[model samples]
Target: MTRMTRLTKWLLLMAAITLEVSATLSLRAALNHPALYVVVAIGYIGAFTALSFVLRAGMGVGVAYGIWSACGVALIAVLASFVFGDALTARMVMGIALVIVGVLCIELGSQAAHTRQTREGEATP
Candidate 1:
């Protein structure tokens, strides 16, 4: 199978994150409306499906999962603040920033390691 482009991988990750966040939010809303449980079910299922595609696209599982969880947490917190009047303090923002930075470091480190492995493989007889 053809490898997915970098943009496609990232886009799939983003879709996964969005679906997860929406599902979580729907869960919260379902407490009141109850009918939104349908959305919660659909969203969670779709999110996992998208994540599977991301993995099949050749992105490392650690990087894909880290970014997916980080973005999902951040988006849920921020969106919930607006949608449900949940508190979003400065400390929470800082924590989200740290999570994002940590994921970025993992991705960069993974890329560097892959490059080194490729070079070493090429150098071997």
Candidate 2:
């Protein structure tokens, strides 16, 4: 693919991540305030839509979802802590760091697997 195409795909992937993050926050809000259920539902629906576009841009579902969810979870944890005044101790920060590291490892592994598969596919042809 051309550089522009690759960039576009990446942008879409980021959009997907953004949507998922928004949906998570909205869902939390809706849960607390039943009247916001419709807004939350819409946010989630938009999130899935963005995710679908990202997949269409050629990202594997596992890889995409892993990155998306990890980011969303991390952001939501921090946001929730701030919004709810939940304890955010040093240990909690350490745990979040670990979560990020684990997710990065998963992304790296998945990327390696994807590159291998692409090489194999090329060789087969």
Candidate 3:
């Protein structure tokens, strides 16, 4: 598989994240009014399409999924409080912070493994 450059991969991942968040928000809007289902479906389609591109760019599945899911959960929670008037409690804030930390750990671990493999390859005859 041809790997994309890190910048390209990150850009794709960001796009995927944005689309996924938009989809989740649209889902909320759709719940109250059935006519908005089309918007929700389109948003989901865009999200998955972008995510597939991100995966194809050779990002590790675990890292990509961890970041995607963690960020999505956090973003949705905050957005819900603003858009839906849902309460954002202290517990929710703490949970979101933990999720961010977990995703960062996954990303850092993936990067370390890649760096080690590159160093090993360079050391070989």
Residue pair clashes in candidate 1: none
Please provide TM-scores, in order, for all candidate models, with all chains considered together.
0.91, 0.77, 0.93
Per-residue lDDT for 2-64 in model 1, tens only? 344878998999999989999999999999999999999999999999999999988889889
Give the candidate number with the greatest lDDT.
1
Q: Considering lDDT, which of the candidate structures 2 and 3 is the better prediction for this target?
A: 3
Tell me the tens digit of each residue's lDDT in model 2 across 45-104: 777887788788787788778877877778777887888676788987887898799878
Model 3 lDDT per residue over 31-81, tens place: 888887887788778878888887988888899888988999999999999
Model 2 vs. true fold: TM: 0.77
lDDT values of the candidates? 0.92, 0.78, 0.88
Q: Kindly give the stretch of ten consecutive residues in candidate 1 with the minimal lDDT sum.
A: 1-10
Worst 10 residues of 3 by lDDT: 1-10
- Relative to the true structure, candidate 3 reaches a TM of 0.93
What is the RMSD, in Å, between candidate 2 and the native fold over all Cα?
A: 2.5
Top candidate by TM-score: 3
Which stretches of model 3 miss by more than 4 angstroms?
A: 1-4
